[model samples]
Target: MKEIRLAARPVGWPTAETFEIAETPVPEPGPGQVLIRNVYMSVDPYMRGRMNDVKSYMPPFAVGEPLDGGAIGEVVTSHAENVPVGSYVVHSLGWREYSVADAARVRVVDPAAAPTLSAYLGLLGMTGLTAYVGLLDIAQFKEGDTVFVSGAAGAVGSVVGQIARLRGAKRVIGSAGSAEKTRHLIDDLGFDAAFNYKDAPVRDQLRAAAPDGVDVYFDNVGGDHLEAAISTLNKFGRIAMCGAIAQYNDVAPPAAPRNLASAIGKEINLRGFLVGNHSHRMPDFVAEVGGWLRSGRITARETIVDGLENAPEAFLGLLRGDNTGKMVVKLG
Candidate 1:
């Protein structure tokens, strides 16, 4: 088996040298364990936080240790009772060709229901669940509310916009890093208006896109985006602080929000959340998102890299806003 380990902690941006690839013997599954042949691995912005030597919702990845993320694979061998060989499953296996994990930690996936197993790592998985819970439960979004989403063309942001529309939001506006992504948001993902944050100042672009002001903000790229959203939010508006992808790789301290006073004056509620914190609501979320997908009301896009060796590059691209949607590594 081949696996990638964290060789060093990165400063500004992670480089190839930060990872070390090694060849190891494929181990057998222990009692109550299963061996998964990883097929697809998810690369998310949160993983960047794990790479750092800071305390977070999850522990940091130790140097020389194999990194782990969400992965979809087939169970090639199993010592567990319920999970048998050939079962498609999702587990946190990190960067490896195969992983031996407790069967309880993996969930069997229905290949017939979802055409591609990768969807379980994106739309039907944690990314989609995060958006659903944050917008519906945390933000308390209602019908006809004008929503503004930052990092709008990426995985969670894209899904957040579609779900808002499906639930009857009057208008959904999105912010992306490039012109092509802006078009993808408006034309493909049903965002009522989209803007390239690079083209103009965030405050100016948001002002133009949401002339009447925003009722709810699903924030993905924080920093200036949060500040801009704060400035434009209407009274009693809610903000879901999902991820701060913009400042993930910064060496210096991030710029503080300049409009927190607006939050107090407008009675805005800004909440930060991790998907794991809402696992109790997973069943309800899955039921609703499944219906949305079956009805073609929500669409998902993925930027897939072909090999595990390129996972680091794919992750770096994600921080730079280079991907259109969910970024995944296909390790067939």
Candidate 2:
């Protein structure tokens, strides 16, 4: 088996040299564990933060050690009582072709529940939950409210807008990095309006997209986008501070979002959330979002990069906004 390890801590943007692929013997599952043949692995914006040796909500990836994230795999061998061989499971042990995971830490996934095993790593899994919790729970979204989403064509943002639209938002607007993504948000994902953030200042584009003012802002890209959302948000508006992808690679502190003083005057609620903190909402999340998936009211798109060896490229691409939806690596 081969696994990717963190070769070094990066200062700004990481290069291909940051990851090392090494071959090793596949480990046998110990007591209460399972040996999984990993199939699909997740690549996300948050991983960039883990590359740096910093204290955060999650532990930083140790240099010279295997890097891990979300992965779905087949339980080829099991030493646990409840989990049987041939069952599928999702775990946080990616960047490898196989994984030895504790049965307690692995969530069994029904292969028939979704269109693909990869969906467990995205829409039906953590990615979807992030979007669901961010909008409905953190932002406290409501019917008839106008919503704006940053990084709207990406996995979490795309779902945020769709869920908002489904929940009867009056108008749903999106901001993406490209024209194609803007089209995907509007035409395919049903975002009422979307704009290419690169075309103009985000504040201007957001103002233009939601001229009447935004009621809820789902922020994926922070920095300038945050400032823009703050400036244009209506009084008593809400913000789900989901991610700050824009400044993840920066060495200097972000300069924008200087309008936070306005939040006090407007009595706006801006909440930062980590999906781990909201596990209690999984039952409601799965029932509601799962029904939407089955009824075709929502879509889970993925940009897959084949082979575990290419996982580094996939992660870098995700940070570069090269994917329209969830980015995953397929391992053979």
Per TM-score, the best of the predicted structures is 2
User: How much lDDT does each candidate structure score?
Assistant: 0.91, 0.93
Off by over 4 Å in 1: none
Quality of model 2 by C-alpha lDDT: 0.93
Cα lDDT tens digits, model 1, 108-165, are 9898887478889999999999999999988999999999999999999999999999
Taking the tens digit of each residue's C-alpha lDDT, what string does model 2 give over 1-332?
Answer: 99999999989999999999999999988999999999999999999999998899899999999999999999999999889999999999999888999999999989998999999988889999999999999999999999999988898998898999999999999999899999999889999999998998988888888889999999999999999999999999999999999999999999888999999998999999999999888889999999999999999678999999999999999999999889999999
Off by over 4 Å in 2: none
Best-fitting candidate, scored by lDDT: 2
Clashing pairs in 2: none
**What TM-score quantifies how close candidate 2 is to the native fold?**
0.99
For every candidate in turn, the CA RMSD to the true structure comes to 0.9, 0.7
